[model samples]
Target: MDTETLSDHLVELAYGPKELYVDNTYRRILDSRYTEIVGFDFFCALDDAIETALIDWWLSDDAFWGEVKAFEHWQDEVEDGMAWELMDVWETWYGADGHVKIRKASEREKVSYDKAMKKLLCEHEKKKVSIEAEAVRIGL
Candidate 1:
């Protein structure tokens, strides 16, 4: 395979999403967390920091495999400890929309370090911060 195709395959295996229109906030969190955990540098698309994070994780050192394993362990603990409470949080905060709920719930599940979440990011301190930023930039 060509270099570009090989690169695509590697990225898909490590961080392919079923859809692209995910909440950008969740993308930022996932991308940033993987960068802090994976311990390596990889080429991310220009300004596509989230894609960069995924590529970095996919191409990182052997420690990255261990990091993924740790995430799995964390996910299990979260589900086992607070299944219903989390589900209710989803229903209330997200809404009844199926797609929104699924993506939000996925975000909640994949979140291991809530301390480093988008909620506390240097730039995106609040969801409304991002929402308003988008609104103003795009004049929505």
Candidate 2:
């Protein structure tokens, strides 16, 4: 799927804001390597808009896809030694899930992954603070 094809499909798609978010992600995925939705054969054949739409319908009611932005955040703490990786992933995450309810990836699996990553990030942040406090108290 090229940019022109994605734009055309977006224009024709009958998606609400939420669905549009999913569609937007799907568009990027189409532009990526895994053009097909794995199980489907013709749903990713470059010009098969209908096929793409069909796959979209199949994934219309995902609960996990809604957690992308809510769970992922940009932690821009210069002291944390993050020059770019954190920023880069976060920026990409925002661009993909920002203006659209764009759907891509499997909701079943991705929701869990996103949730776990968020949880771990929070825990790591808390640990960092606790370690700093300990160091300060010990005059180290």
Top-TM-score structure, candidate number: 2
**Model 1 agreement with the true structure over 55-128: per-residue lDDT tens digits:** 56544545655554555465466445454544554455444675544335456554633433433344333433
Candidate 1 deviant stretches above 4 angstroms: 1-60, 84-140
TM-score of each: 0.23, 0.25
Per residue, candidate 2 scores C-alpha lDDT tens digits across 5-53 of 6456455553443344445543434545566443223333433665455
Model 2 earns a TM-score of 0.25
Each candidate's lDDT (Cα)?
0.46, 0.47
> In candidate 1, how many clashes are counted?
0
Clashes of 2: 8
Could you tell me which residue pairs clash in candidate 2?
Answer: 21-100, 21-101, 21-102, 21-103, 22-101, 22-102, 22-103, 23-103
**Candidate with best lDDT:** 2
> What lDDT score is found at residue 41 in candidate 1?
29
